[model samples]
Target: MKTKQEESATDFLKLVKNMKYFTKLKSDNSNGDLFNVTLKTASYNELNLMVSCLLKASICALKNDNSGYSSASESGIDVLLLLEMALQLLPDEEMQLLDEFHKNAIDRKAEQ
Candidate 1:
């Protein structure tokens, strides 16, 4: 039997997997050049750490008692760092495509 925390973590993983933003690949094949970005799933350890941190943050936030809370900035930075670790798991090719996409977005914004 799965513990409540484990169940919640599994549910969160399922939610993330089903989200198109995370799983979808961006591809545009024009001028005989193919630009493909592959989606990479987080490793078991990475997912566990991320879920644990997120759950702890949520639990702290929901505490109505006069107990102290973690600094918002610290929690936010932890989340960001976790996300960065997840992204770093992507393959080199995928990272390159992502960088290209980011650069294109920046260029577009600059044009406007």
Candidate 2:
């Protein structure tokens, strides 16, 4: 039997996978050229790290208690940090695509 933490981790991973698939589908539907390049050259490890941070941030948001609450900025910062880490890991060619994605994310936040 898996421990509670392990089960939660597994569930989080599944959630992240589904989110990635949806994001990819949305990207493909919106911008075929960008989707094609991202699908072809994206780093799985970086994606995984980004998803993990997102999941954690989501959990924090949901668990807002009397002590304090998680703000959108907190989550956004975490994601940006992960993106920076990913950029460092990727080659110059791939970094451009990641930068585009990062800019899109920032734009979405500004719109919200």
Candidate 3:
């Protein structure tokens, strides 16, 4: 029998999937491009850490190469330092605008 916490965690994972969070994932291992493939599945603990930490790291990308998020980290390369250099190349206003646009899009979806 599963404990209540276990059940809740499972449910939470389900919710994330239902919300399309898992729909946009790209393989870090490019087909024949990279020497090794880094197939990763976020563990429950890791997901908890990410959510609790408000990770803005874009280490992960969408399967369709559309949307992504990024965050700061201490290590030169870790789970959370994605697109930092590319993001730096972007203007602050553009970032802010993108944020606002995303919010609006989500709000519109929720309204529907």
Clashes of each: 0, 0, 6
Q: What TM-score would candidate 3 get against the native?
A: 0.26
Residue-wise C-alpha lDDT for candidate 1, range 1-112, written one tens digit per residue:
9999999999998888788455355556663464455644477566456656656655554452225455545445454555455455435785589899999999999999
Best by TM-score: 3
TM-score of each: 0.24, 0.25, 0.26
lDDT of 3 by residue, 19-109 (tens): 8775444445546442432334367455445444433444233221333233223223354344433333334775688899999999999
- Please give the distance, in angstroms, between residue 33's alpha carbon in candidate 2 and its true position after superposition: 16
**What TM value does model 2 have?**
0.25
Q: Top lDDT: which candidate number?
A: 2
State how far residue 36 of model 1 sits from its true place (Å). 16
What lDDT does candidate 3 reach at residue 15?
94
lDDT preference between candidates 1 and 2, better one: 2
Pairwise TM-score winner, candidates 1 and 3: 3
Segments in model 2 whose C-alpha atoms lie over 4 Å from true places: 1-42, 65-112
- Residue range 55-108, candidate 2, lDDT tens digits: 675455545532366554655545455444555444577668899999999999
Q: Which of 1 and 3 is the better model by lDDT?
A: 1
lDDT for each of the candidates? Answer: 0.61, 0.63, 0.53
What residue pairs are clashing in model 1? Answer: none
The stretch of ten residues in a row with the least summed lDDT in candidate 1 is 59-68
